[model samples]
Target chain A: MQYITSLITATAKPPPDNAAVFSRWFVNHSSWGVLMTVDGQGFPFGNVISSSDGGTGIPYFYLSTLYDPTGMNALKNSKSCFTLSETALGTCGQADPQFPKCAKIALSGDVLRELVSVEEDSKEAAFAEAALFANHPQLSGWPKGHNFTVFKLRLKNIFLVNKLAPARYVPIDDYFKAI
Target chain B: MQYITSLITATAKPPPDNAAVFSRWFVNHSSWGVLMTVDGQGFPFGNVISSSDGGTGIPYFYLSTLYDPTGMNALKNSKSCFTLSETALGTCGQADPQFPKCAKIALSGDVLRELVSVEEDSKEAAFAEAALFANHPQLSGWPKGHNFTVFKLRLKNIFLVNKLAPARYVPIDDYFKAI
Candidate 1:
């Protein structure tokens, strides 16, 4: 198989206000994104995690510090990218018949770490913890000594695809706008 | 963070009666079960493809025939695993609000090569091709040589999740039953 690896960059277009295209796609589909990072040996480690916003409209996620070797490696490496896609239903399983199984969106970019603080009294710390908890309700009862860290993807590129149309590449700025 | 590699090895389960769940979770969420192979130099390569039937109603996917560099490296070394998830609407952007944004699944197993064929008179082949083309209408006019090679995944483990539920890891066989 031929491997293609160039960072495609483009400005995000303001999606048509009435365009239910992306919204419809996200609904009747499962949302998954891949995280790419380098290990200590410098080998690329690609893993997937649940993506969500803290109910505040900003994309974030909650992951177990104990179960994420790749995430740890990513934090250590300090350089990582994510790839997310929205595909047609037929492509996944025999899920929905009314929907064509082919539309998708992939977002790939760098990762930045945001360390969680223990002090709930500090406004800054409380805000951060609240944000993290909003996306990860399971973390509400974490035992003491457990460490949690939040990271953000400094998005680099966004790939929007519909088997019905040509694929489009949007740069970071445009991606946020389109979002 | 710990990197755990788990396989979904069990008897095959019957295909889901409603293929909707499978299609929605897998095809629509194509980013969920991406195969991560490494190049000759140990660089990673990822692709999103669906598995074909293994004659048991269970879905399966395969590696490339030519032993692409990454596939070769992955085979020589140990196979790696990844997890997939998505963000809900209104949370990420002005996308689908009614649909749960967070959909996640975890898949693990070795990458293996399997032989597949399109019989000269096989209606299944025609149907599969038509389904593909209908979603990707542009491909309707493309030359056959440009098509991707098809393969099936011999599943070892499969896990799935929705915002309202805890993640469930189904043995390959059980996964079929759940469908």
Candidate 2:
């Protein structure tokens, strides 16, 4: 796991109560997390996927329908959620992963696939490529035949649990506004 | 994350194709992972939870409905999945988290809550208590008022992705039979 965090940029953790800034920092520093999607049977399926924020609070993904159940499931039903634990970032210290102070966040939203042709030179494609490759360099080398596509979460609810109290729902506007 | 692995027992890695041995070794050494459940809105929700097998290869959990959305969601709809990534074990090295060789697993089943009265000297209660607390000692100190219950996945499917090929479905019997 130390190797996993070597790529995480050094970012000071904001106070636990500061949902907007904390959430932004969390996503920015996290490169991978569980992406939950409703399966064809309607059961929740959690899949490990690489992600990057590209300094934006929103998470972007590089997925291939040919190999990923998550991507296939998302195409059928966009309802999805992405979750990250401080455990993954190696910052939870000795706290139990589920411990509130260990910090966890769930970004609930629909997975919107971008129709970007990287070979055709579109700004959207450029942004998507940079967002993913900058953080997940391996993704850039995946077989092109896998038809990996860029997807982003159309966030509707941001759930942050970082303290002893109940989880807080950061206003969606505040999430985007955070530096 | 080095501290996180300190608690993991020194279990030798089973070969990639040995799904049963590998899955068991993976789960036995791992203490926590994402537990996915269908939320009230029928969306998939993944929550981080502590787990243990007590060397039985059957995963067990200590969950409190009063504090865990995963526990509450299980009560409403038993359909669920538990996912673990080798990345958490510090065994994946530099492979992308989604890399097949990094080894990930998902156990899909219904979460069956066990009715155990530890105070009443039930063997089931004793097993459940030891299963979780043995791996997650902090769980024993959690507030008793949280009304934590023991739950187990009634495993129907064992999905393992440990190679370049498509993920494999390990027969349920093989999983339980693995040492």
Candidate 3:
């Protein structure tokens, strides 16, 4: 399976419009991001993972609730944060990663499990399954015993810095609309 | 001032060696990473930041105690985690970001204050300043009042995944030696 992935790169400098459109563009085009959750000691633990689709502005994961610490952390405390860097896509030019223009965003929200046993619709599950498989075909063939279930972070707040100083907080409603 | 940066892409795969060399390479070549700390609510908060030359295998940052929450969190509880991804470098080709072969590393350590007032860094301070400026020359010109002082993470544990399951743990000594 072919995976087409790239960070924001150097050319596409979305104007700093404070529009949810740029946030949506950054989130959807990127292939993977770091997921953070509170650990047993109450410390933040972050892990790199692939999302099913950023186009929808919601990130999907194939997680084993019993396998990864992130899952365990989520089960213990649903409050979590997801972060992505436009520099990771390699578009920041000579700018430092922290350079406001390099573009960094953190979405604070709750990560909830969506399984066939708990969800209302079988069709939504199937659609999600197909999306996950299409984006990460290899995940579809992983060991069945891993018991990987799908999870998504429903975002509540967005903190973004795309240029210069002073980061912007994107409202949840505006973010979805822009996407 | 021009910068030429690209995620680790199109290069021949490293020899499936889950060695410290590969991990060090990924860290040094990547310009920025996500730094995580415990928030007031005990949730892990992550922000993207520029790291000085990773060639030494130790990431140094210029942060403002009055500005970034990462600095505030560090002052409260010195422990933190720094993460970098080959995917950020645009490498890994078609592999998903979570793929073991794509290389993701989390360096768990303590964030230390390195100002001349805090420690007697006689020579070490100068070396660090030069390294930081060489890799991130733009940072040197920022307003001094932002109080962006240099800080470095004293690595305690290395969680690296370069090829497959069972992430490798590179000892601090081993990591430095490889660097």
Q: Which of the numbered candidates is closest to the native, going by highest DockQ?
A: 2
After TM-score superposition, the amount by which residue A134's alpha carbon in candidate 2 deviates from its true location, in angstroms, is 1.4
Sort by DockQ, best first: what order?
A: 2, 3, 1
Residue-by-residue lDDT tens digits, candidate 1, B12-114: 3213332224423343333224455444443344545433332223333323334233245555654544444344211234322112334444455555433
User: Mind giving the per-residue lDDT tens digits that candidate 3 earns over B34-139?
Assistant: 8887767666778997786435667878777777777878888876888888887777888788877788888888877775753456344555666777778877
**Residue-level lDDT tens digits of model 2 in B28-121:** 8888888888888988888888888777666788888886777888898999999898999998989989888898888888987875555442
Q: Rank the candidates by lDDT, best first.
A: 2, 3, 1
Please identify which of the two predictions, 2 or 3, would achieve the higher DockQ against the true structure.
2
What is the docking quality class of candidate 1?
A: incorrect
Tens digits of lDDT, candidate 3, A64-176: 77667777778888888888988766677877777777888988889877756644634455555667777788778776676677788878888888878777889888877
lDDT of each: 0.41, 0.81, 0.73
Identify the runs in model 2 with alpha carbons over 4 angstroms from their true place. Answer: A1-10, A117-122, B1-10, B117-122
Each candidate's fnat: 0.09, 0.67, 0.62
TM-score of each: 0.49, 0.90, 0.85
Model 2 has a DockQ score of 0.62
Clashing pairs in 2: none
For residues A41-61, write the lDDT of model 1, one tens digit per residue. 644555555454332222344
